[model samples]
Every structure is written in structure tokens, then in C-alpha cells.
Target: MRKNSIKNTRINGEVQKELSTIIRNEIKDPRIHPMTSVMAVEVAPDLKTCRAYISVLGEKEAKEATIKGLNSAEGYIRRQLARNLNLRNTPEIRFILDESIEYGVNMSKLIDDVTKKDSNSHRQDEEQDEN
Candidate 1:
């Protein structure tokens, strides 16, 4: 029943790339953080709604302000989408905060702590064996 046989991944990727570029180059909101980057995009099967995960490299308030700015500019963004993309309908875009980058940093720190502990324990064992 698929018309084009295009996979969801491809469609999602295309939407993500185009939206990110459009947001970066076109949007001129002062509240938008300069470090804002589109982390991921999830488009519905019918391509009517898209959830865009964004990472703002700043404090909580900055992130909030950036989201508010994006929300306010959603109409303009959608219009830009219509101009850039050839889809029959422009999907409603929802901005979401992506904490995966922070989570990954935390996870890496935990791993480093574990690794340091393991190395220290190995050193102590070797010293004991020498004595």
C-alpha cells in the first residue's frame, strides 16, 4: 500500500537535515541559543507531526527560552518547511529537549570512575604480591 516505498528512516533523516539547516540559517530569533542543534527528529508514519529533539549548550533558563522562541516561531518554521520540502502537507513541529548528550557525559564519567577504581585495585594487588 506504500506509494513510494521510501523507508521511515530516510524520510526522518531528510526532514531532520532540512529542518535543522532551515532553522539554523533562516530563523532569526534573538532568544534562540547560538549553540542550539537538532539532535534527532521523529516523524509520524503519516508525516503529519514531527518531534524535533534539540540540544541547547547552556543553562536551564537558556534552554527554556530557546524552546519558547522556537514554539512561537513554529508557524514561520512550518512555512519555511513548505517552501523547502515538496511534501503535500507540512508536519506540525514540536520542539523537545534532548538530554542524551548530558546523559552520555554522565555515563562516561561513571565509566572513568569505575576504570580508575579497577586500575588502582590492580596496582594494589601487584604491590601486595611483590611484598
Candidate 2:
């Protein structure tokens, strides 16, 4: 099967959904923050390995701790995935920190600030013209 085949995509989506549920409801590790979320999942064509991208809305330390907690619970998570998905090979899971959401929010804030400044300048120019 090709790496980007529909089968792989379906597997990836299923894994992501199951992982989100497992992490949110099953895992009770204290190190994981309440705001942690599974952002995306990518599974290899062979289904031997899977990468889960996680996003945590918290400080850097919290994010690091969450990743550590998830890594420590990797075995349990894989087992749960196997039980839930009934796959022949429960892919070895790897947790990766995803910062794209945070980056996007920051970029939006910056754009808003620039837009506000430009509008204020335009208003001031209009006022001067009226004088």
C-alpha cells in the first residue's frame, strides 16, 4: 500500500480519535495538563509506527511535563488502542509536541495590532485634513 493511500488516512484518523478519547478519559497521569489535546496523528504504511502530535495550552514546563507523562504511559496507550481498534499490529506510538496552534494565534494577534495601528493613523490623517 502507498504511504498516502486512503487506508493509511483512515487508520490515521481512527488512531487520532481513539487516542484523544483514551488520553482524555482513560489516562489519569498528574503530569498531563487538563488542556492537552491530540492535534494530529500520522501512521506509517506498514502500520508499525505512529506519530501523535499533541498540543498543550500552558507554560513550557507544563508542556514538557505533559509529554513526559504521555511517553511514560506509551505502553498503556498502545494497548488501549489495540483493544479499541482491533488492528493486527498496534503501532508503536510516539508523542510529538505541536506548536502550530500557538504560533497561529500569535501571528493573528500581531496582524490585529498592525491593523489597529493603520486604522488609527488613517483616522488621524482624516482629522488633520478636516482642520
Candidate 3:
């Protein structure tokens, strides 16, 4: 199947959803942070392997620990995924840390700060004009 074919897209969505649910509800590892989120999942066309992008809202140690925890629990997660989805091949799950969400948030804050400074300067300029 083509990488972006309709069927491939559907499989990616389904796998992403099921993986999210399994990680959030089934896994009980303490190393996996409570604020962990599965940001995205990409299943290869062959259905033999998958990449799960994860985001953890915590420090570096917590994020590392969460990945470690998930790696160790891969077998159980795969079993749960196979049971949940009736696919020809249950893809091997590989966890990857995604920082896009956090990056976007940081960029937004920077933009807001710049805009606030610009507006304040504009107000000062207006006052100086009036004076």
C-alpha cells in the first residue's frame, strides 16, 4: 500500500487511537508519567513495525523514565493492541519522544511577549506625541 493511501491513513488513525487508549488505561508502570500523552503513531505500510510519538509533561528524568517504562512494557502493550485491533500483523511498537507540542507552546509565549512589548512601546509613543 502507498504510504499516504486511504487505507494506510485509516490504519494509522486506528493504531494511534488504540495505542493511546492502551497506554493511558492499561499500563501501570510508575516510571511512566501520569501526564504522558501519545501524540501520534505511524504504522508502516507492511504493518510490521510502528512508531509511537509520546509526550510527557515533566522534566527530562521523567520523560526518559517514561520511555524506559514503555519500552519494557512493549510486549504487554502489543498483546493488548492485537486483542483490540484485528489486523493482519500487529506492528511492533517503538516509542519516540515528541517535543512539538511543547515547542509550539514556547513559540506562542515568545510571540505574546514580543507583541506585549510592542504594544507597550506604542502606548509610550502615543503619550510622547501628546506631550
Best by TM-score: 2
lDDT score of model 1? Answer: 0.88
TM-score for each candidate, following the candidate numbering: 0.86, 0.98, 0.96
* Candidate 2 residue-wise lDDT, 36-107, digit = tens: 999999998888999999999999999999999999999999999999997879999999999999999999
Each candidate's lDDT (Cα)?
0.88, 0.96, 0.94
Q: What tens-digit string does per-residue lDDT give for candidate 3 at 44-125?
A: 9999999999999989999999999999999999999999999999999999999999999999999999999999999999
| Tens-digit lDDT track of model 1 for 44-122 | 8787988999999889999999999999999999898888888767899999999889889989999999999999999
Model 2 / residue 82 / CA error / Å: 0.9
Ranking by lDDT: 2, 3, 1
As for candidate 1, its clashing pairs are none
Q: Number of clashes in model 1?
A: 0
Error of 3 at 85 (Å): 0.8
Better-scoring candidate (TM-score), 1 or 3: 3
